[model samples]
Target: MDNSNGMAKELAGFLIKHYTEQLHSIILSPDPRLHYPLLVDFAELLDDNPTLAHLLFSHPAEYLLVFDEAAIWAQKVIFKDLKQWDNASVKDYVHVRINVSGSPLECPETFPSIGRVRVKHRGILLTLKGTVIRSGAIKMIEGEKIYECRNCKHRFKVYPEVETRNVIPKPTICPSQSSKFCESTRFNLIEDNKICHDYQEIKIQENAQVLGVGAIPRSIPVILKDDLVDTVKAGDDVIVTGVLTAKWSPDVKDVRCDLDPVLVANYVRRMNEVKSGIDIPDDVIMKFKQFWLDFKNAPLKGRNAILRGICPQVFGLFTVKLAVALTLIGGVQHVDASGTKVRGESHLLLVGDPGTGKSQFLKFAAKLSNRSVITTGLGSTSAGLTVTAVKDGGEWMLEAGALVLADGGLCCIDEFDSMRGHDRATIHEAMEQQTISVAKAGLVTTLSTRTSVFGATNPKGQYDPDESLSVNTTLSGPLLSRFDIVLVLLDKKNPEWDAVVSSHILAEGEKENDNCNEDLKSTWPFPMLRRYIHFVKRNFRPVLSKEAENVISRYFQLQRRSATQNAARTTVRMLESLIRLAQAHARLMFRNEVTRLDAITAILCIESSMTTSAIVDSVGNALHSNFAENPDEEYAKQEMLILQKLCIIDEFPDLKSNLQ
Candidate 1:
C-alpha cells in the first residue's frame, strides 16, 4: 500500500490474469458496444487477495486510482501484445469500477441502512441500498489537465482534488528544470489536455418496510461519474457501493453553510425485482408445504388459515382479506403481438365508513409487502402520486412519487376519497398500464410503476346500493373501472353481526397472548406470511387452462349481454381483469395452471365488487362474510347456481340479471 507504483503494477497483473476472457471479448470482438470503467467484482477480488481487498475498504480513493491506472495499463499491454489495435483511441476507454456484492455487507447485520450511517462511518467503504427517488442531470467535469506556468514557462500535470472537484491548486514556485530562480505563481491552463467524465446526481430513500414501524425513511444524495451516469433512473431500487464523504455546501445569503454528507458511488447495481433481497429458507418452504399437505383435501381451509394472519386484529372480513392476498400475489404479465405489455398487477379499493378497519388493512398490507409506501390521500398531490419535477441547485430533477418508488411491490393510499379528483385521476394510468408518463419542466420520460395499489376510501354519505361507485365515492367511472376489485366495507348496524363481533373481541382479550406465534398452533405469523407471499409471487406464474378460459369467457359474455347502465363498465378491461384475477388465484393455490376453481373465485371476487349484474343480486355483503366449514362446497354450489342462472337468463331475457 505504501508503494503506489508497485501497487498499481500488482493490480494490473491481477486484472490481466483474472479478466482475460472478458477483456478479450470487449477489446478484440467486433461488437461496437464500448465498455467503459470495466466492472470487477469485489467478491472476486476478495477471494483472490484478502489483504488488498480489505485495504480497499479503508483506502478506496487511493486504490481506486491505482485500479483505474492499472486497467488502462493492462489494456495498452493487451492491444500491443495481441496486435489487435486499429485506432489508438480504443485504449483510452478502460477504467476500473468495483461492484460490491457477496460479502458481510449483504448480511442483515452489516447491511448499511441510509438512516443508520453515522459520522464514524465516513471514508469507509460501504454498500447502501435504497430506492432512487430523484435523479439529477448528467454533466461533464474536468478530470485531469496539464498547466503551463506563465512566468517560468514550466509545464506540469494537475489533477482535481478528490474532496473539492473542479479545482486545480496552483504551485507557489515553478520547477522549470535548471531555472530554480523562476518563482512564478501564474499558470496557463491547457483546456484541450483535460480529461472529462460524465457526471450525474441521484437521491435515494430507505425502504419503509425495512425500517420497521414508525421510523421515518431517510434520503441521501449520491454522486455518479463516468459510466455510472444515466445507468439508473428515478424509481430504481439500487445498491450503491462507495466511500461515504462530506461535500461543502454552497454559500447562501443569511444562512449558515455546513458540509452535507453524500455518497460517491463506486458501483451502482439495480435490483430488477423488488423483493430480491428477501431470503426464504428451505425449512420455511418445507413448513409451508407441510401446512398445505395437512389440508390437501381442504386446500381452501389452508388458504384461509394464511388469510387469517392478514390484519388479524380486524374481525371477519373474508372477502377483503382474499382480495388482499390475490392483489399481493399478482398475475403473470405478458406482452402481446403489438409489443404492448399487459400489466398483471391488480389494484384494490376498500370503500368503508366509520371504523370498519380500512386503515388497519392498509397498514397491514404494507407490512406484507417487501417494498411499500404509505401516504394519506388528504394532502397527496399528483406529484406525489406519480413523478414530480423539482428545481434543485438550478436544475430540473425528477423526484419519484409513491407509485414510482413502490415499483414492483405495493402502494397503500389511505383516505382515498379525501384526495382531489385531479390527484385520483393521475393514477389511472399507473393502476392499469403500470407506468407514469411525465412531461414537465422540459423533462419527458416514462417511469414504470408496476405496483398493486391498495386504497381505502369512504363512500359519500350513507352507502347506496343503487348508485354507481363513481357517484358514491366521488371518483369518475373511468377511474373506478381501472381498479380490478373494489370491496365496499360498509359498517351496517346489524344486531347479530355486532353480537358475534363483540363476543369475538371479548374472547380475544381473554385469551393470553404471551405465547402467540405464527402457528399458535395453526395460523401463520407475520414473517411466515410475508415469506409465503414473496415466495409465491416469485415462483408462480400461472397460465389460463381451457376450463378457466371457458368459465371466464362465459362470465364476460354474460356481463356484456346484460341490459344495464353498468354495461359500459364491462368493456375489454373487465375481461382482462377476469384473466388477471384468475391467474392470481391459481398462484395463491400454488399451481401453474389456472383451473375452474380459480376462475370461479375470480368471478366471486369480481361479483363482490359489482353494483348490478345479470344473474344474482344477493351475493351477500363482503364485510359479514366469514370462513365456512366447507368453503369448497359453498363455492361449488355458488358456481353451479351461477351456471344454471345464466341458462335461465338465456331462456328469458327479462330477468334483469344482477349478480350482487
Candidate 2:
C-alpha cells in the first residue's frame, strides 16, 4: 500500500482498462445488484484520472456506502431467518416501501411505484441510486404505526400501530394474497406482562404472507466519505436483499453488501452525460416546424407541451445538460456544478402551471444534464439556494447553493410561486442579467449564476378571462416577462374528449401503440431539438437584418400603441423576450442574421400571449369601472338610481356591473 509500491496506480489503471473495454458494450442487466461492483471499479480506476475523479467525487474523505436494494433485501433475509419475521421486532424494523395508493387506479394491473426511503441525518451527502422516496411518506410513518394498504384497502397490524391501536396481528405465511401495511407507517416495540404468547392476539389471515419481503436482492457496500457530506444529509442510492423491514419512525435502514460501487458509477455517469451533435433529418425538422406552427395558432391552455412531443425537447432546453453539451464542445475540464462558470446566454427559465409536466420534465432534464441539477421549492429561501457563508478550513468560506451546484448546467425549480417574495425578487437580475449579487457576512461578491432555470407554478385560483393578473395570482409581471418563450398551456376542453386523451396518454405507455409514430411526428424530436440548440450555439454571432429589424420595430410599435402612454416601456420587456426567442430561432437555422421568418415567428408567439392579456385587461377594466365607484351607501344608492334610469340596473347587480 506504500506510495512507492505503485499499487494504487496499478489498481487504478486496471480498473480504467477494464471499464474502457466495457464502455462500448451494453450491460443489459437492469439489476443494481449486478451493477455495483462495476461502479466501484470505475471509481477506483478514476484515481489515476484525477480529472475524472474530481468530476465524480466532490470530496475525498470518508464515504458511507449504502444500497437501497441491499437494505431491503437484508431486512427480508433477516426477517426470514428470525423465528418471527412478522413479530413486534420485525414490525418495528425500519425500511423503504412502495406507495401503491393513487398509482393503482391509473395502472390497475401493476402496482404504482411509490418512491424511496430516506434516513434522517444531518450532514451534506451525495447519493447514486434509484429514485427517492416521497417525504410525506416518511412524516406519516414517523407519526403512526399500523396503516391500511392504500392500494388494496387492506388493514394489517404492526408494532407502531400495536402501541396506538387495540390489537396486534399474529404473523402468517402464504405465497399469494400477502398481508400489507402503509409503506410510511412506523412503530415502536413493546412487551406486555399481562398477556402471554397467545392471549387474545389477532392473527394474520390464513395462508397470507408479507408483501415484497422475499423479492429484494442482496446488498453491496461502497466507500462513504465524510468531507463530501452537506449540512443537510440527503439520501443515498443502494441495492437491498433480504426480509423487508416493517416501516419504522425516522425511517433510517442499514443495507448489507453483495455488489460493489464500480458498476453502478459507470452506468450512472454514462447515462448522465450530455449527448451532442444529434443529427436529425431535415424532413423531421420540417414536420416539427409545421406542427409547431399549427399548434401556435390554436395553442390551448394548461398543456401546450403535450399538444405533441414538444415536452421532451422543451424539457431539454432547461436542463444543465444543455450547458454541459455546450461546455464539452468548448473543451473545458475540471468542471464545477456551480452556475457561475457559464456566461449570460446560457440561463433558461420555464414558468407554468400544474400538470404541465413541468416537474416531471425538470427531473428528467436534470438527470441528463452534465452539470448537476440542484432543486428547491419556493418555500426555500434565497440564502438556502444560492451563496452562504460556512466554516471551511477553520475560516468562513462562501458555500455555493443550488445555482452554484448547477453552475455549468441548470437549476430546475418547482412551486416557484410558493417562494418568498424577497427570494423570488433576488433572482430577477440573475435571470435577465445572468449574475447573482450577494451581500452578506461582510462579503459582497457577484457570483456568475449563469444557470438555466426551469420553473413551474400554478395559475391563480381560477383562470380569468379578463383581469390584470396580480403578482399574488401568479409570478410578478417582471419575472413572467423574462422567459425567452412564454409558452402558454391551453389544451382544448371537452367532456367527450377525455376518453381520447386518456387513450393517447395510456398509448404513450405502450411500445406497440399505433399513434406513437404520429405522436413523434407532431413535434420536434429530442435529437432534432438538441441539434437545433447545438447549431445555434455554434453560430453565436448574430446580426439583425434590415427586414427583420423593421418587422421587430413594427411589432414593438404596435405593442406600444396597445400600452398606455405611461406604460410604453412595459412592452419593451415583451420585445426583449421576442428578440431572445428570435435569436434562438436564428441560431437554430445556423444563420448569423435574424431573418424575417424568425422575427415573424417571435411576433406570432408574443401576439398570442398579448391577445390573451389584452382580453383580461379589457374585461377587468370594464368590471372595475362599473362597480368600483359606489362604496358608500349614499353613493351606492345614487348609482343604483342612475343605473335604473339608464336601464342598466338589474336584479343581479354584480353581473350587471361586470357587464357594464
Q: What is the lDDT, from 0 to 100, of the residue 161 in candidate 2?
A: 26
Which 10-residue window in model 1 sums to the lowest lDDT?
651-660
- Off-target runs (Cα >4 Å) in candidate 1 are 29-35, 41-51, 76-81, 84-90, 104-112, 116-119, 148-155, 161-165, 169-192, 212-215, 250-256, 282-294, 511-519, 563-568, 648-660
- lDDT for 433 in candidate 1 is 85
User: What tens digits encode model 2's per-residue C-alpha lDDT throughout 317-426?
Assistant: 22222222222222111123774332334333333345545566566555544344445565468866666665421334454556644554567777767788888887
The best candidate by TM-score is 1
TM for every model, in the order presented, reads 0.88, 0.44
Best-performing candidate as measured by lDDT: 1
For candidate 1, the C-alpha RMSD (Å) to the true structure equals: 4.6
Pairing residues by index, what is the TM-score of model 1? 0.88
Backbone clash pairs for candidate 1 read 518-525, 613-657, 613-658, 613-659, 614-657, 614-658, 615-658, 616-658, 616-659
